[model samples]
Target: MLPLWQLTVAEAAAAMDRGDMSAVDLCEAYLARIGALNDGLGAFLTVSADLARIQAAQADARRAAGERGPLLGIPYALKDLFVTAGLRTTAGSRMLADYVPPYDATVYRRLQVAGAVLLGKLNMDEFAMGSSNEFSAYGAVRNPWDRERVAGGSSGGSAAAVAAGLCAFSLGTDTGGSIRLPASFCGVTGFKPSYGRVSRYGMVAFASSLDQAGTLTRTARDAALVMGAIAGQDPLDATSADKVVEGYAAGLSGRLDGLRVGLAIPEAGDAEQAQLLTDARRILEAAGATVEDVRATADEALIVPTYVVLVTAEASANLARYDGIRYGHHVPGDDLAAMLGAGRGQGFGAEVRRRILMGTYVLASGYQDAYYGQACRVRELVRRRLEATLSPEGGLDLIVGPTTAGPAFPLGAKLTDPVAMYRNDIYTIPANLAGLPAISVPAGFSAGPAGPLPLGLQIVGRRWAEATVLRAADAFQARDDSWRRRPVMATSAASA
Candidate 1:
């Protein structure tokens, strides 16, 4: 039998339902695992053990009262970007390191209502920027597979925790591949729902239009269970969609018959990744789905630049409120302007400042139309191209690709080269541009110098088609047991 800490969300829930485990037992198990492993991984910014115990006990009491839900009694963690009442929400930046919110994010509230225990806040890239976890002020989150390699970002900690079994699952925000990239590196399942499918209220803003809330788990079914718990329209967030939320876990029949799966053949820089793409298509085709190669019309070279422009511009606007006068770090000065300047200068990290400067330049008077405006036009073109290709008339139900160019690279390998770092997100950024649903499932492993490193197969679906995406991923996952292979570090942690 699997240890309590290693059980997936669905398995953990079933254990509790069958009286084999109590919510308190589950929470304590996770706390023990975190205490034992978090120092080596640097996955969490905080561990709210006392609060988690309270929540778990409450869940146990609710279970006694006959209440039932998929996430009931499940232990989980957040990406630290979501505001939780009385919990520090740093967004992985020192600028807001000491800031705590007075109210819960809609997503957090929904999970709490569903009886999921909050383990703590996970680490991320400072202000949700950077492809590697190195930008975090707290420190980089190391991949569980190879401690010297990066876990990817800006949701690095979320993916690491799930992969390492520190928690059953974790919540993460995706903007330009933050969730998917990290999940790929960490060897877990990360699902980024269509924009507005999940509420963004109380989440620290990076790129308002591109940012989305999602989940990281060991399996697509676990992601589906958590998605059902947290996804729906929220009155607090104006951007939330009003469409009916489906019971995602209950609907995962894993039958892909008649599904039209499109194999997106972009310029895969790595030969192994290209082969993985071909294998993914073969797997889907064997499951009774129509598979066809679809050439990418949007130039691969344009994705990173356009994403950089739009996100930086939006980030510059969103970060303007952190002048230290409002709530964050305050540096005293003789005048208001001086005080604001000093506070911002001392509070934000180097990467944050670089992005802010680039954003300001792009949005500046003479350059706005030339840079930011052109980027917007390119974004629209990319979105339209995806829409046309995935439309019913186009006969493509889902687009498949490699989540990353290769596998996890060594930490600090590309930190000095921003362009090189930005290219890490090339494959996953298009889905965010189109506001489409996408997921990264553990594909297989690549032999690394230190050990085996995991790779991912990315499946993207049209707007508001999370069910379809989950179904295809679940079917693919069911076809093999490769995802069950644990990282050496994670296996040691589980045994200890």
Candidate 2:
């Protein structure tokens, strides 16, 4: 059997059920892994050992009482922005570094009800603002595969922690590919459900329209288990779907029979990446699915710009509530304006401030129509284009492509140029814009300057089609086990 630290959520639950291991045992193994790797990797901003032990004990008690569920006794961590009652929920910014929510986020509450243990809060970009984890006020999340490279952004810690065996699985938010991008870099399974598939209540807002709760796990089955636990309607979030949540794990039959897959070769322009997608096409075909290359009618290049304009505009408004009076870092000043300015100026990181300024300018009077308005119109076009192609009558059941343009880059490689950094998400931003379900599965390894870096294959489906998306990914995993690979550094660190 694999070590408890290396067990996937599914494996851990099975082990616990058979009495081979308990939730406490799983918790301790992960805690030890985090203790050994977190300082260098920066995967966790906070480690709640006491809370974890308490939860693990409760989970064991429930299991003893004959409560059987897939997630019961599973240990998982949450992104810092997912507010936890009495636990510091910093959105990776000094502004909220000390703030503790009075209530837990809907997703966290759901996971708790399933008897899952909380490992702690993972680090992220301040206010979930940047493509690279470098924008984090805490510190960049170093890729476990190579400490010198980034683990990817804003959910970098969540992905890193899962890949490094620090947790069974970790919840993250996907706003402009935060979860997918990081999962790709860290070599884990990242699943972003359709918009509104999961409640957003209590999740620190960052482009609320685009922000959706998701998870990073060792495999698609693990992601399915977590999704089944967390995906449901919530009275707290009106945006949450009122529809019934499907049994996600049960849908993973490891077959994609009668499904039509569209391959976006243009998006996978690089020879290596294109070959990976081509291989994926063949794999999907062999799995009882018809695969064919499909070109995008809409210009794919406009995806990033449209996403930036809209998300930044939304972020500018969402972040305005952090004034000193509203419970955040306070800076005293002689006048109200000065006090507010000082508080916000010092509280926000450079990236957050930059985005706020950009958003504010675009939303300014007389410029709204020229920028924000035009961007919204363009966004509608992009969404329509995607919806039309992925609709039931639209010939395609899923779209396959590279999750990112390439593998993880060296830390701070594109930090000086935010545009360059933003472009890294070019392949991923489209799904967010269209409010679709997408999964980034570790597809293959790319030979890098240091060692073999992981590349991810993205499978996107129509909005509210998470089951289909997850099924496709599971089928792919059945053929290729790349998602099961862990970084070498993590192995050595855990052994030490």
Candidate 3:
């Protein structure tokens, strides 16, 4: 039998429903695992052990009354970026280390209603700025497969926690590849729903326009389960789309017959990405999908520049609230100006400060039209190109590609170079730019001292098409056995 902590939420729910296990017992097992592993992994900023037990007890009561939802009795963690009522939502920033929100995010409240047991808050890049988790003020999150390498970022802690069985699943946010990249590195499933599909009401702003809350889980089916619960329109967020959410779990068994899968490679992807894409294509073909090599129409290059301008412009406006007088870090002193200046300067990490500076510069009076304006027009054009390509009349069910350029690199390797680090997100960033639904599933691996690191396949669907994306990911996952297995780290072999 697989370790209880390693079991997917579906399996755990079924077990609980069968009376084979108690919610309290399962919760304790994961709590113990987090206690044992988190010191080395640095996956969580805070673990809510007391609140978890109480929630578990409540779940047990609900089960006794014969009530259950997909996530009932399942222990999960939040990417510290999501506010949890009364729980410290640091967003991995020293600026908000002791700051606890008075209320929960819409998604958090929904998950609670679905009966999920909240374990704690996972670590992340401060303000979700960096591509690597090293930007976290707390510490970097280590990959479970190879401790020396990163687990990808800003949701690295969420992915690492799920990979190491510290939590059965985790909530992560992706502004630009944060969810998918980490899921690729950690060997799990991560899904970013269509913008406005999942409410962003209480998620701390990184770049409000681009930020999206998603799930990192052991399986695509588990992702479907989680997304089904939390996805909906919210009165709190005006941007929340009022679209009807389908049964994402039910879509897991969707047929692949007559499905058109687009392979977005201009001159073919790089060797590593090509191999991952090739493997993914074969899986799709075996599942009855028609794989076609689609041309990029010269508009693909605009995705990054357009996304950066839009996101940074929003970041500049959204982050103005952190001026020491509001709910963030404040230096104690009689002079208000000195306190605000020192607090902000000392609180934000290098990457966050860099982004703020860049945002301020671009939004300045003279450059707004030249930089931010042109970017928005280009964004509309890119959006048009994507919609035209993925139209039902144009014969496309989903777009498939590599989740990242490669697997996770060493911890400090990409820190010195921001542009180089950002390149790691090339494949995954495009989906975020379009505000489309996307998922990453383990496609293969790369050899390493710990055996090999994970590779992932990304599936992109049209707006509010999470059900289709989940179905495709589930089919791909079902066709592969490699993702079912995990590397065994020998405790006897001590690290130098």
RMSD of each: 1.3, 1.3, 2.3
Q: Whose lDDT is higher: candidate 1's or candidate 2's?
A: 1
Candidate 2 structure quality by residue, lDDT tens digits, 353-429: 99999999889999999889988888888888888889887888899988888889998789889889878888788
Computed on alpha carbons, the lDDT of every model, listed in order, comes to 0.91, 0.89, 0.85
Worst 10-residue lDDT window for candidate 3 reads 487-496
The regions of model 3 sitting more than 4 angstroms off are 266-268, 296-300, 490-496
**Number of the candidate with higher lDDT, 2 or 3:** 2
Clashing pairs in 2: none
TM-score list, all predictions: 0.98, 0.98, 0.96
Tell me the deviation in Å of residue 458 in model 1: 0.4
lDDT of 1 by residue, 226-286 (tens): 9998899999999999999887887788778988988877654477777777778778977
Predictions ranked by lDDT, top down?
1, 2, 3
Lowest summed lDDT window (length 10), candidate 2: 487-496
Q: By lDDT, who's the top model here?
A: 1
